[model samples]
Target: MAHSEIHLELLLGKQVLDSTGKPVGRLEEVRAEREGDEWIVRRYLIGVPALLERLSTWTIGLAILHSLGARNLHGGYEVPWEQMDLADPQKPRLRCTLEELKTLEQSNSQ
Candidate 1:
């Protein structure tokens, strides 16, 4: 990590912008892996579904929302950490367009 690079903890809840400066969503969660002694962030999950996951007891609510197509209201995407530019920290931007990012998979928790 660069001296100016911010940690993933600081990145949570930060808004993410596409390469075109379009607002996508906030950084709801981060996926990381431990390599040797360092924890390297792999992806930044942005959307309401990601946010909902943080609330562990929302299973029934989430299922209802999904069944009613409310999940589409808060569609989530996962951007590879390497493709993100966090120089501003407050407004991390993706190197690619929003469509290029991977769509987050929904769980089978119905």
Candidate 2:
């Protein structure tokens, strides 16, 4: 809709929800290709949730923070562009949500 320019700011802090519409991850950082003076996004560093599934939210939160090498806490996930679902123009974060992501995880284990 808005074009490439609108997509610039969207690279940072983009919330990446699972297919079930549950918060699973977010965009930790974006790696861009640099040519001469211009730096264009090449890929992204996803923030994966380090918290154990059954662990207390607070406990997992701290672990997630530690894994991130950050002083604070923020549990999420990291993935490549191909893994994310970008269907809706409005919800530019992710379409994978929790439930769908769970299915994906389960299948990957087998």
Candidate 3:
């Protein structure tokens, strides 16, 4: 199999678009695991919630938002590794629609 390399830093904070060219969110965090000397990506986290998670303040941020009556304000998406098109690392995009991705809440419930 052929593989290409992209610096994680370049992907961070990049706005990810959907299949139809609609903006989804920024690439805030990347979920990966070590395997046989390789760090394999599992998924890409996007949006404000992802940013909070990357900063290790997800719980606290959510609590504050809820307390402020902003229950619906916190949101994000979890794009599976296979769902993201990284061919253009500078402008990462989703292979699927936003609706097909798992929301932060949905992933938390699982």
Best by TM-score: 3
Per-residue lDDT of candidate 3, residues 1-110 (tens digit):
77667799889999999999999989999999988978989989999999999999988988887899886664799999999999989889899998898898799899
- Candidate 1: worst-modelled 10 consecutive residues by lDDT: 101-110
Sorted on TM-score, best first, the list reads 3, 1, 2
Best by lDDT: 3
Q: What's model 3's lDDT at 76?
A: 95
User: What does candidate 1's lDDT look like per residue over 1-110, in tens digits?
Assistant: 45344676788888899999999898888878988977787887888777776565346667888798864464578788788888788888999998787666642222
Cα distance off (Å), candidate 3, residue 13: 0.5
Error of 1 at 74 (Å): 4.4
Candidate 2 lDDT (Cα, whole model)? Answer: 0.49
Clashes of each: 0, 12, 0
Candidate 3 ranges with C-alpha deviation above 4 Å: 66-69
The model with the greater lDDT, 1 or 2, is 1
Per-candidate TM equals 0.78, 0.41, 0.90
